[model samples]
Target: MTPLDKIRNFSIIAHIDHGKSTLADRLIQRTGGLSEREMSAQVLDNMDIEKERGITIKAQTVRLEWKGHVLNLMDTPGHVDFAYEVSRSLAACEGALLVVDAAQGVEAQTLANVYQSIEHDHEIIPVINKIDLPSAEPEKVKTEIEEIIGLDASNAVLSSAKSGIGIDEVLDAIVERIPAPKGDPDAPLKAMLVDSWYDPYLGVVILVRVIDGTIRKGQQVKFMATGTTHLIDRVGAFTPKLENLPDLGPGEIGFITAQIKEVAQARVGDTLTDAKKPAAEPLPGFKEVQPVVFCGLFPVDAADFEKLRESISKLRLNDASFSFEMETSAALGFGFRCGFLGLLHLEIIQERLMREYDLDLITTAPSVVYQIELTHGGGHIDLHNPADMPEPNKIETISEPWIQAVIYVPDEYLGSILKLCQDRRGIQQNLTYVGGRAQATYELPLNEVVFDFYDRLKSLSKGYASFDYEQIGYREGDLVKMGILVNEEPVDALSMIVHRSTAETRGRGMVERLKELIPRHMFKIPIQAAIGGKVIARETISALRKDVTAKCYGGDATRKRKLLDKQKKGKAKMREYGSVSIPQEAFIAALRMGDDA
Candidate 1:
């Protein structure tokens, strides 16, 4: 084992596509963590989705040996949805490599993650990445780092990770500048459960950073939060691939298999201690994550409901932040009301369910949690699903979650971005200039921001704008549930809570989109969007008519009139009694209308 003074633990934090993973790949290669034959682009990103999307969904850890010192590096996801992952990774390390795109300078996520590093009291090493690009201005980025992040970047490393530039200098800087972790090996085992995931062969594999004492194979460890003990089956570190180790000592990061059946039991951020001699107190900074978005997930075929449940449970073992509970929809049948970190998280979970488990799913419109204040001295209750919302009569006031967003954009696109925010009922909190770019901060309802807001922001800015947001609590609003009715029957999956001002336009958009999506039937189908008893928007799917008049040929005018009257009567009766057969495709397409609208 390396001495405490010779070990450096650090994580790479950056904005999306700023080359965090590429830097990690270069580090692993330079340190000989993996051979040339085994090396690949984004070597640490092992998942297929991560490779395809070119984004790290989970924070990955690797142990490397450079010169004489032992280096523990974590490659963290840079997207706003995975900020929690970055934070967890930061908690395990004493230093962070703050990567900034030389061309783009400081984006929103760069500031966000760097602030998190500062909060963790990490020694941050500023690295100007993508220096090989023609637009790259390493000096400008260095200034931005100093001005925006308030970190001295005069000695910041200038490198192009793609071309392996400054790789050695980065290593040298890490060893010289980043402080060595200080922990007590003589003390009882106190490891931080940075992350955990399910492994088919060995069960739950936990990634831990040993803070005090050592963790050895066959040692009984207790999870402080869950109050469960498990016998360690294996101890190892990821050299980009699992390599068995005898034990992980203080200031070292590694993995351990404890024969735990589920990852839920090995909670992330939990303290792991020797079962025989438990630590006097668990480590601090542990808090449960509250999901920001909620939606119903149902198998397209009702027969696959049980399979979906099994698949979701298996998925939950991998994602501790995702939460789900059983829910039945009148239109969609059995399903689970699942909560996620954000819109991207919802999409990833849906995609994984379909791809990994081979399950076809129907997802409802995603909505943010609402707080409903009841009338007559009734207590407040958190509303997850709009369909489950209490009656309007009992609701004294409905408050929706709000978020404070920081957007970084070029000055040319500032006007358009501000307009888009205003259209979402946003209130501008502050706006300032950072070099040629504008840093605009706005407080907007989370419900408005959730639907295609990021996509809109990017398009308006020509993909130059970067945004990051955090929940700022709830505020009272004129919120009302808008229910969509097909053939005058309410579709629970299509129901959503909306502000009163935009209800008409949103309702009209949904009804108009549904009119195009739902196929015509023998009887006329009336699609209506309603708020309470008021029908805000309405559309009619014209009936598929037969040529009853054509069969009449050239008869008396009354004969044609009589045939039309009879047909109209028959259609009216069918409209009254006939149930609309809405295909699964319609619901799928209708929910996506929010993005388009």
Candidate 2:
């Protein structure tokens, strides 16, 4: 049995693009976890989307041997959307390697993740990475870390992950500084399943951190949360690749493949214990994740409904955060209303469906849940879709979800950032400065930032700012549902709920954007944005006119005038009887309006 003192289970935590994956690659190379010929950039990032985007979407674990110590390294996603996954990764580790880019210093996500690690009570080893870059400012970043995060930076390791500089020191720090795992191997089996995925042949494969006792092949294990039992078909460790192991003892990170068919059966945070002699109680701190943002996902083709459903089930095997239910839109047809952790999470899932499943999807604008109290009665209902909202007269009060957003930016752009936040009706919570950089906190409506706030903030700050947010419950706001009409017919897919103050501006923008997107048809089309029954803004697309004068060759001026009059009358008749077909591109344009600018 591997001695508990020789085991060090830890994760690398950092903001996105701060060299977490690169440093993980260096560590894997240094420890001979993967041979020199087999090493590649972002070795821990397994998905094609992850590699292309240069970000980790899912947390991955690997076992390494360094100086007789069994070091299990977990690489976690850095984006705010996957913060919950990062938290789960931190729970399995005894320590964390906090990586910061020397050039970028500290950002919003870095601070958020640092606080998460601290909450987990994990020993943190600060590392200043990318020292080889000409813009590297290790000393400056170290000072920032010390001043902002309140961690000692004098001993922080300085390294260039790309150049393999100071990697030895990082490995040494893990061996000497991080505490080893401690648990009783002789006790009843207890393991926390940190991650899980479905396999075609082996069925559900669960990645677990064995907290107590032992888990072995052929033993029956019970999932405490689901109360399901299955005989373990195989037990293995990821030495960069899955290799069979006879048993996994306490403090070891490995995988257990049973005949469990459904991925939900082996949920993350669920406890796995020996069925014959289960632990007296399950592990502590198991909380199910709830999705915050929701949108409708429908296939462009009606026949692809089954295909979309099957694809969703397959994707659900890998991602457990997203939830979906059958929803039908009058315009969009049959689809599912899917919920996500955040916008980025929603985008990733959509991209996966398109790339992996070869699906063409039309996704509605994302929305947050609102609580609406009935004036007629005293009861309230949660409204996720604007189409499902009760009549305005029936609502006593409507409360929209709000979030506490923290932004880190240069002091110079403070005014612009604050203005942008105020435009979104954000309330200033506090503001402070750290090392010439400003940290601004605001309580903003979640709907405001859910769509294009991040893109706008980055553009305003010239990409020098970073932001993170957490839901702060709901608050009463003067909100109204804005509807879009094409040729005086309301388009249900283009309806959105917005604040009263900016309703006109938003509506005007949508109408103008739609005018540019919709192609000129045989009949004039009027694109109008209306709140309730009143039109707030309108734009018109002129009809495509065919020159009747062109056919009057060698004719008199009177003949040409008569032909023009005849054409005008025909166009008027066609305009009254013909219906304009709005193209799919127009809908897409409306969905992405204000996002580009």
Most accurate candidate by lDDT: 1
CA deviation > 4 Å runs, candidate 2: 301-303, 544-576, 595-597
Query: Which residue pairs in model 2 clash with each other?
Result: none
Q: What RMSD, rounded to one decimal, does every model reach?
A: 1.8, 2.7
lDDT of 2: 0.89
lDDT of each structure? 0.91, 0.89
Q: Which candidate is the best by TM-score?
A: 1
- For candidate 2, write residues 117-187 as lDDT tens digits: 99989899999999999998899999999989999989999999999999999999999999988899899
User: Cα lDDT for residue 85, model 2?
Assistant: 70
TM agreement with the true structure for every prediction: 0.96, 0.94
Worst 10 residues of 2 by lDDT: 588-597
Cα deviation at 217, candidate 2, in Å, is 1.5
